[model samples]
Target: MKNASAINGYEMFVIQMLFSGAAAGFIYPTFLIRSTEGAYWIPIAVWIAGALLSSWLYSRMLARLEDNKLIVVIRSSLGTIWASILCLPALLFLFGALIVMLRAYSEIITMTMLPTTPISFLNGMLLAPASLALAGMMPIVRAARVFFLLALTCTLALLILGFSDIDWTLGTPLLRTNGDFLLDKHFYAGSFLWMGFTITSLIGSYRMQSARRAWKSYVIALFCALPFIAGYVYLPIMTFGRELSQRLTFPFVSKMDSIYHYWVVFENMTAIFVSVTMLYVLLIMALQLHALGETIKSLMPRAKTGLIYVIIFIVVYSVATYLSSWRAVEQIVFITVGIRLYMMFVFPLLGMAVLAFAQRRGGKGNEI
Candidate 1:
């Protein structure tokens, strides 16, 4: 890829924030509420901490290797065989994320807006962003910039509008469970919420001006997403209480429905919330498909981009449609949480080890 066509730090920041923020709109809150029960804040904190640590480590690796893509760094440091082996999990993690999120968003739409509309139709609508992705990374990044401001405005508006119904007292017993919750098997399951940081590895090769600036953009994006994520989980608990919030399909949407917007045209703000979130989801799916295409190109340099996209679209659309029910989608998502956790934490450390080994063998000259 030419340096001129690559995305800058601000564009990367916008894309990452939109991708991560989309998780906040739908799945993350549900997982946090389910796993932590009354102590959802503890898990949320853990996920954020994990995200920051991974981002820092990833940035350090990017600086040391000076490669635009993590796959290139891995291939350079570890050779083709080992690098391909390592990349398999990362690819699966990306594809798994695509499947889970595609179904999750479709489920949300069916439950909220189009009760009678088939999920197959919703899944097909999602491909709209894939068309942009087919044009290449620049289009996806530019689209992210366009959608970022509008998404941020609508998200903040919903949060501010929902504050009127927040019952702070419902958040009692902050530490309902003991510290054991931190070590619980499911603690890291929330990692999916913060997996947006992985975009650094995916897009790092896209000509970031400075590692320092790129890191700053990453940190800023995380902070930008904090309020929305925290509110997505906490606001609902504060509004509906722990038990009821946990029971609802989407407590955040429920919270939005409870709010009355006098000046707004739509009687229920949940529709607007869904519309904005759908945009976010579309961008995320585009990025995922883009990542899949890039990974395939990296593996088979001679492969056609059109064929790669077709395969990705087929796999994603087939899996998403065949899931048949929300419960099935939930099961797949739960299974992939482990894979996501591995990619988020262990994969980068492995890359660090490869870099260290390569540096020891050839010193600075062989770093890239």
Candidate 2:
């Protein structure tokens, strides 16, 4: 593991921003719109609240452990047997997320940019992530830092340009929908969008300087992403109305398509939006793959990092290829929502318990 000093607060912020930004785009807006209808903002609010709470819980655990990696702390508090057992779900969660994201992005690319190209050809894009993961952590962090400015600029520009079509009245009577919708299974299912702050937990130990900075970075990143997320969800509904927006698969992209730019070089702004978003998604997949490799190394100390990444690449590629159609991929995405919720809530509680156990045992020197 690299020293915490190697990673500064700004880099940490950029990493969180990249992950959260990518997640905020794409299918998340669709899930939020479909689940909440007119009351879509309600779930967005709930998601933000849930994310703050989760980040707080994780920050507390990090502080108590004196900045040790979560996997190490888990093993120390619970014996290797129990720690390995707990890690099983986490491993599954990471891999499941990887598969779902890979399939989702590929499906979108096949529909948008490469309609005539074979799905397999589009899936080859996984090689980018595979190469990044194999290169190790520093390269990924550097890439995030380098691209963060351009990506944020373009995204904000797109959002600003999109405001011309907004109709404030479309989101009226925000909570008029049936209250039961808030408690529905799909409501919490969409929490993954905001709950992406949890990505900090996976990579936090690497370049984390202090728990306070980490927490602040997370909070700031969430706020930074708020406008874009809101624009992604509400802009579509405001432009197309809730009824029509709900029916469309990718309403935000569709919203972009509806905009015509006569003075611009590219006739379809959705193409530009897709291109920018694709860069962010590639970073996300690479980060997930790196997290999977770290998880495996924690369990088997002797595992070769290269071999671990190769195995992950093969598994993800094979599964994504097998689930060839949109319906199959959608099912996988819905199924993993439950898994994501489990990890979001359970892991933090487990961390608190582990911290308490360690404290009772007078294990103050447990810092990794």
Candidate 3:
């Protein structure tokens, strides 16, 4: 690993791109399509506004830390006991994301390309990311850069191809909503799509960077992903009416299979979609594992970090493999909805409050 300062806003941007891309493929659209009867974009718009607000608070919290780890900064602001209590939910959030991601992607593979492949074997995909996570953040960033290029090119081509066979009339009621999604649990479950800012905060602070710059990078990355996210949900709805689109598990993949072009080189568009999304999923999984490792190290400075990474890999992989069905993956995500909401909205506010209190009391206030 290199100095944490070596990580810059652009590197963070690329990583966020991967996180957003993976969500576009896996769970985000399913939840959105099911949660609303009117305009799907309304729920998306609401979530984006929520994400931007939470990200602003997080950047403010990071600004006060300079080059300190978030947990370490909180410990300096508050006592060890209070810091640990505040940080535990974040740790659980990371672990829950890992479980849901690993299981969900494996289930996707089974449903798409490799129907005969065993779930346990497909779940072994975590080993690659776990190894990279142990190697440290720089490697993951470098890998994200490479994967982002390939994944972006492939993804853009597919999105273009998806426009070939759509009936615009089927998409009537393009922009109608009565705010029904506000009461849906699936709407809350979709918060995972907007969690890139929160996840990257675990990497500690960048050297000499302003909070505004970090926040802007995330904002840009997320907005750039709007087409991909919107296309994933709406493209399928336009192709197959909402009723049929809601029934399919991987709607975009089904949309891809529906695309038939005489000039196109590929025989199977579904395979292309699955393969490209795999790159995004694997890289983001590595990012999550790295975040989890860093959080545990901050909490227990004396523990062997390598051993900690191994234990995390083993535990997450085992649980993900043993999940009985795809329904279980969604259930776990639904169960963790409260924790995700806390991390998104409450955690940053609490961190900022503690820092302000410590500075007022003249305790480690001048360190930054």
- lDDT values of the candidates? 0.77, 0.76, 0.86
Supply the TM-score for candidate 2. Answer: 0.92
- Candidate 1, residues 23-103: lDDT per residue as tens digits? 777776776776665466766776678888887777666666654566776676677787789888888887888888888
Tens digits of per-residue lDDT for model 3, 8-40? 678878988899998878678888888989888
Highest TM-score, which number? 3
Q: Ten-residue segment with the worst summed lDDT in candidate 3?
A: 204-213
Question: How many steric overlaps are in each model, in order?
Answer: 1, 0, 0
TM-score, cand. 3: 0.95
> Over all chains combined, what TM-score does candidate 1 have?
0.91
Per-candidate TM equals 0.91, 0.92, 0.95
Worst 10 residues of 2 by lDDT: 200-209
> What order do you get sorting by TM-score, best first?
3, 2, 1
lDDT of model 1, residue 320: 90
Measured over all alpha carbons after superposition, the RMSD of each candidate to the real structure, in angstroms, is 2.7, 2.8, 2.0
